[model samples]
Target: MLALAAFFSGAALRICDGLLPRLAADFGITAGTAGQVVLTFAIAYGVSQLVFGPLGDRYGKALVVCCALFGCAGAALACAFAGGFDMLLRLRVLWGIAAGGVIPLAIAWIGDAVPYEERQATLARLLLGTLSGMSAGQLGGGLFADSPLGWRGAFGALCAGYVVIAVMLLARLRSMPSAPPAQGGRLAFFPQLAAVAAIPWARLVVGAALLEGVFLIGALAFLPSYLHQRFGIPLSAAGALVALYAVGGLLYAMAAKPIVRRLGERRMVLHGGWIVGAGFAAWAVAPAAWWAGPIALVVGFGTYMFHNTLQTHATQMAPAMRGSGMALFAFCLFLGQAIGVWMAGASFDRFGALPLLLLPAVALPLTGWGFSAALRRRAGAAAA
Candidate 1:
């Protein structure tokens, strides 16, 4: 139930990305302006995790998760009835704030309940829903918008799903154990925040995760519009292509444990970064629509491969302060995404979509080099 709730919350946000074109057309706005909906959501999503993470530590994961889901559902319902573009944008910001807690809190709950050795496989299962939800958001949103039901109806359907998940979560809340009271005052929170900030390896991992967010959210949010503008494909087809990106991620989630076992997490992160960089480059140069599918797959797989490893390391970084650590990790990640969307939107407005792909192509390799250098330094320090 917890995992499903997290999945739906994520899916709801993702659906908005694919629905951008139709929504923009309906509201008589530019694609760049419509992109603000993505920006608003990303910013709220990132910031809210900082608040909810501590709340989970102080109160309980179950309570935090339920409240976030209910809030998300309410926001989605409100969005369904939004009177104008501004109204929908506000609702999206609220929705992002509420939905933000679901991922980090869900991961923290798993950390509290599961052992380290057992976590790889379990985390993979949880991520399956997360990635699948992203895919559904694209495909399902496209379908909803194209059909007689329309974009508003699609949001309504999401609201209904949220309600069901909320009910189940509320019922199950009593069976979950509450976290013990955290030590110190509100000021103490700063120390944990500082602890995460102080760790060199943690900073590197967070940087990589932030880059991952930039690539993932920025690319997915605009890919449909880019395709329509460049290739003149309809919205549904473009959305379906975007949906295919998740197939690669889904495969990586299923295979990640064995791959990590064989290759080691650190090496996997390094290699995955390279693969993603290559994917971005491929997308930049591809001459036809057929090429987009394969490049997107590479991008998707590589992005998630590193992402999974970064998340595992983050959860282990400070076991005692798992909530704060994970929350900070999420904060950096979403902050990167918000910046990516804004920059990409501006770049698209000025230079066009093709140039935007170069940002990740350049960024991923640099991030990968940084990760490798950090790993070597950690090894040398241990040897000394």
Candidate 2:
């Protein structure tokens, strides 16, 4: 049920990638300018972490998730009929705010529910729902943008998905025994967040999450467009190929259990980061359009390899305050993504795609190694 609810959030996050060119054309803006559609949403989603994290602690995580799903539905509905680009951006802000609430809290809920030893595998299974939705949304955005139904239709579909999921989750919520909210009151979430932030390990996980956002999520946003301009692929086709990113994610999801057992978190992050970095490096220099799909697949797998480890850490970072911990981690994450997208858009406009693609390829490996090193240090400290 939680996984099903995550589908719309992932869908809404990536739909703009496929819709960017069409939005640019329709709104008489540069493709870079059209990227504000993504930027606004990301910013709102990031900023929302401040609000939702503490609120979830004060309220029930499941109930917070249910309400936020409805908020996403409302914002998406508004987005469908936005009269101007400005209006669309506004609606996206609302959409972002709502989306901010869902996944982090859901993970926190999972943290509350699952044992640490088994949590990573459970999270991997949940990721399948998100990756599947991302695949459908990315492709649906391109297909809808190309058809008479258009980008608005894509949003309409998102709204419908959110509504249905929200109802289903709400129903599930009712059947379950209610969890008592964490102790707090109005305006107390900030101090709660501060207390969690004081932990050295928590800071390390949050920082890595921020870098991952910028390097991966932010940079990858431009890939569909990169394929379109460089290879002259149709937007729909470009979207289809890039949507394979989720396929890569799906592949990792299926393999996560065995891989976790074999490599554990340290080696997983160590190798996963470089693998993703290498995939992007390949993307920068791929000789032909045919390579896009397979490369995206590889990149997606590495992304999860790196990212799921971070997620597992986030859930446990502040075990007593899991809601605050996850929220802060996600906040910096999308915040980094927003910064990444903005920089990538500028980079694309000024320097072009090579730098945008290659930079992360190089930087991500460092990110992985740094985090893995920290893990080793902690292990050594534990052993001592």
Candidate 3:
């Protein structure tokens, strides 16, 4: 039920990605400016996680998550009826803030319920729900928009899903675990925050996850329009192609444990980074429409492979403070996403889509290499 709630919350935001061009056309805006609609959501999403993380730690995961869902549902309904681009943007920001708690809280809930050695596979399954929900959102939103009901109808459908999930969550709230209060009152929050900050490995994990968010959200948000403009594909067709990105993520989730075991986290992350970089470059330079599909698959697979490992690593990093650590990690990850969307929007506004692709291709690999190096240094210090 928790995972399902989280999935719906995430899917609601992703559905917006597919509707951007249509929404822009409706409101008399450019694709770049429409992209800002996504940026507003990303900014709110990232910033809200910081507060929600601590709130979850202090109050309880289920309660916080349920409330977030209700808020997200209300915000989605507002977005459905929004009169202008600004109104929709404002609603999206509110929706982002409300939905932000779902992911971290879900993960923390898993941590409370599951054991460490078994967590990798469980986390992968949870991520599968997340990735699949994203794909479904894009595909479903595209189809709904193409129907007589239009984009608003599509959003209204997602809003309905949110309400159903929230009701289910509220029913389950009594069975959920709550973190114990700290000795230092309000000051206890500082220690968990400080603990995550002080750990080099934790920092590396968060950094890699942030880069993953940059490539994942930024690419997904912009790619549909890019394909539409470049290949003259209809929105539905473009969204279907975008769904291939999640197919890649599904493949990674299926294969992550063995890959992580064989190659280790550092090597896998570095390799995944290179693969993602290659995928982005392919998308940027592809000479034909047929090529874009495979490139997206590669990029999606690599992005999730790296992200899954980072998330698993984060869960293990500070087990005693899992909620706090995970929250901090999620904070950085979403902050990167917010920045990615903002930058991608600006890049699209200025230089057009072609240039926007280059940023992730270069940034992802460099960040991956940096993370790998940091891990190696930590291993050496441990040996000493």
What candidate 3 gets wrong by more than 4 Å, as runs, is: 177-192
* Full-model lDDT for every candidate: 0.81, 0.90, 0.79
Clashing pairs in model 1, backbone N/Cα/C closer than 3 A: none
lDDT of 1 by residue, 304-334 (tens): 7777777887888777778888888999888
RMSD of each: 1.8, 1.0, 2.1
lDDT of 3 by residue, 1-384 (tens): 876886786577678677778877788888878887778887888778767767777787778889998998898899889888888888889988998888888888788778877777788888887888887887776676567776789778878988998998798788766667334456677777787779878877887778777765776688887888889888887788887887788888888778767888788778888898888888888888777778877877888767776787788777667777788888788777777777777777787786678777888888778877887887899999
What order do candidates take by lDDT, descending? 2, 1, 3
| Candidate 2 vs candidate 3, TM-score winner | 2
lDDT of 1 at 319: 78
Predicted candidate 3, C-alpha RMSD:
2.1
Better model by lDDT: candidate 1 vs candidate 3: 1
